[model samples]
Target: MTHRPRSSARRGDHSHGDVHLHGHGHAHGHDHPGHSHPTGVRGVLHGIFVPHSHDAADSIDDAMEAHSQGIRAVKVSLVLMLVTTVVQAVIVAFSGSVALLADTVHNLSDALTAVPLWIAFVLSRRVATRRYTYGFNRAEDLAGLFIVLMIALSAVVAAVEAIDRMVSPRPMENIGWVIAAGVVGFLGNEAVAVYRIRVGRRIGSAALVADGIHARTDGFTSLAVVAGGIGVLLGFPLADPIVGLLISAMIAVLLVGTVRSVGRRLMDGVEPELVDRAERALGEVIGIDSVDRVRMRWIGHRLHGDALVRTSATTLVDADRLASTAEETVRQRLPNLDEIAVRVVAVGS
Candidate 1:
């Protein structure tokens, strides 16, 4: 939120592996290894395309990659949502259960949220003008907020439907079809899981990975509701309302968790893991006597940070080398870093 740089403001500023194979493995603390530092025109293309490199931790750059990754993810999720929603609606109609109907409605919103995010991704790619120095890095954040809002509203509706069903239990019909539909939805959820994990790792996006986790959990929750439907048809008719209550509780929990997550991102709460890794990386930078202190956080999927470093109190030329070397080293550590800065601190007070 603080503008740490300006036209003349020389104010200092501040992943992949197995992402190719499976749910882009957990973002390791290790920096990117074996990156081909491009030169001449290659460097420009590198800077333009790779998104991160030595000193590539600019805010706009981080946002750009996230915007691009968000688009790909939205498209994949959109198709999956559409496919699952149709199945859910058909099964819910045949089953005569509001719980299933509500689930169908919730699935439909996934597609709705993706559309706007896709648009934001497109808009975010534009070059920043004099008017906007950050070049729309916040676009993904806005789009992210929208997706979180949709999740909240869908949970609310799901909860309300569950309450209605609990009030007047409907004799569920076509139990087999409900179970079949739930199975289909669970499959779709796995598909989402696969896509999100793979792409998230490739791009190093925690948000997309989180989305995958949400989808995976939603599948089980839907399955639980389907089990209730089947049980109702098999004689324990009260099971329908009982599972409905459970689904309501699950929805409420998911809603709260999702909102809290998005709020944290928007409000700028740094992740502890990133902070720890940053501290270690800063310590490793060549010529850096000590890191002194580090402040790192997420901007979308991209990481941006500033470090107040205590050097050995070398000369001016040595100081610049120390600062740049430290910055570049930390930059290499985080493949998705958009901006990273190291401020020289004299050892003495």
Candidate 2:
């Protein structure tokens, strides 16, 4: 006998020796093994410098709720980044600091990146249609590609401006205001980074996580603007353009990781660890003989997959029960799991 279970509901149908089950229920547990924060001094440093991708403190089990949270995070971060960019722009005009100008340009791009992400999150909520069976979830990945282009464009613009300033060697004015603007930029970008990364990890949104990492890099580059201002204060006029060039270089280097991450999703590549976890969950089910195969992918921030399991259950009733248990086990193991199809086949058949 073979059994296939459906998601979003639980009912059973029997025909011949085959069984089909479907229905919906809530999962109460949120225990994810090997996804805990580090301890000791390393933990503190990691917390300060590198944010974890998963945090149990705010994990949302509901898909719709996760989408709502993602939109809210984008909205708030967008406002903060816009304010920071405006403040930096005013300072750049008064101080003529190429470094500040570079940072401001990148920040503006970062803020605008939120618009597409917000649209994506909203589009992901639509029901699947006949023409687009997977719904609009892939819009999120497309938004990620747009973000990559924006980052690249900002890098090119910054590099060109820095080179021009280096050639002309203009004397920077109001060094103190430039330093103050740098401080403002760092604070704003860092705050947005922390918020976006936290929410992105909580919801498993790779696009949002990439944006957050971008913001974090921008924060560090803003500090470089401060360094340039101090150098100018000490009478090194070339330092401003030099720091601008370095910022452009940093952005170009950082673009590689974001591209790889978004590309992996577009190619349907998932972390091996997620597959391993699904397999383990299936194997642990009471009536399952073995986990034959597991395949998973990210659609927007949610996980959806299918698995094949072998079972000794020879009758339709036993197979249906086994399939339901196996599916539930996998769901409990993985947070933000939107859907999973479990197929059970009789062993030695």
Candidate 3:
């Protein structure tokens, strides 16, 4: 049998009475687990440099709130990045720093990437229609693919500019302005990176997280521009083109992780730990004999899945009770779960 609960709110408390069974169906809930930190120096460095994206402790329980939070993060970061790009562009005009120009171009593209994500967030808020049964949540994933393309485009542009500069060297003027602009770019991108990543992780948005990583890398690339400027000051004209080339390579390297993350989601790949957690939750149900199967996928920032369990309950009423309990238990275990189907099969059947 299936147990599905309906509610207007994202994470309202529901009792067994609230769940109505109509054959094999599903239920919905919005809650998440807490976060835990690892120990040792390695763990500390990892935490500081690469914070975990799916920390349950910071997750938003309300679906609407999560969307709102994602939109806010995108808007704020977009403005910050644009301002940084404009500042760097002004410096690039008179300074003739190829490295700064490359960084500025990438920053501009990064800022534009947020537009598609913002549209996706808005589309995701649409209710599921008969034709679009699953709603527009997949728009977020599509936006993620667009982000990857933008990153690739930026890398290509930076590499080409650097190569041309290397072949025909140009003396950079306003060395101090280029250095100051690099510092400004670094500060701006870093701030946006931190804000985007924090909100994205809390909202379970892979697209936002990817964008944040892009910005973080951009910040470092900006620092490379400063190094290039200093090298030019120290009588090394090749440093500017070289650093620009390095920035391009760095962008290409970082693109791999973002591609893997977004591609995995499109393929419906979920963390193995989440499956293990679901199995353990089902096994904990008092009357369940065994967990037959559990499958989960990401539908935007929320999770949806189904579980099959063999139960010892003989009567229909008993089996229904067991199924309800199992569903509830799974929801509690996976707070980010948007919907879950708990199917109970008789031990012999």
Error of 1 at 334 (Å): 2.6
lDDT of 1 at 73: 83
For candidate 3, report its TM-score.
Answer: 0.85
Q: Please give the TM-score that candidate 1 achieves against the real structure.
A: 0.72
- Please provide, for model 2 over 17-100, each residue's C-alpha lDDT reduced to its tens digit, 9 standing for 90 to 100: 222322222222244323444456545534544565547445676777888899999999999999988988988888787756
lDDT of every predicted structure (CA atoms):
0.58, 0.73, 0.75
- TM-scores, all models, native as reference: 0.72, 0.83, 0.85
The digit string of per-residue lDDT tens for model 1 on 141-214 reads 67667766655555565566667777876766567777777787777876875676456545544455446545
- Give candidate 3's whole-model lDDT: 0.75
lDDT of 3 by residue, 265-333 (tens): 899987677788889988988988898888888877777777777876677678777876776677666
* Cα error, candidate 3, residue 167 (Å): 2.4
Question: Better model by TM-score, 1 or 3?
Answer: 3
For model 2, the stretches where C-alpha displacement exceeds 4 angstroms are 1-50, 53-57, 89-106
lDDT of 2: 0.73
Instruction: Provide the lowest-lDDT 10-residue window in model 2.
Output: 10-19
Q: Return the clash pairs for model 2, or none.
A: 8-23, 9-22, 9-23, 9-24, 10-22, 10-23, 11-22
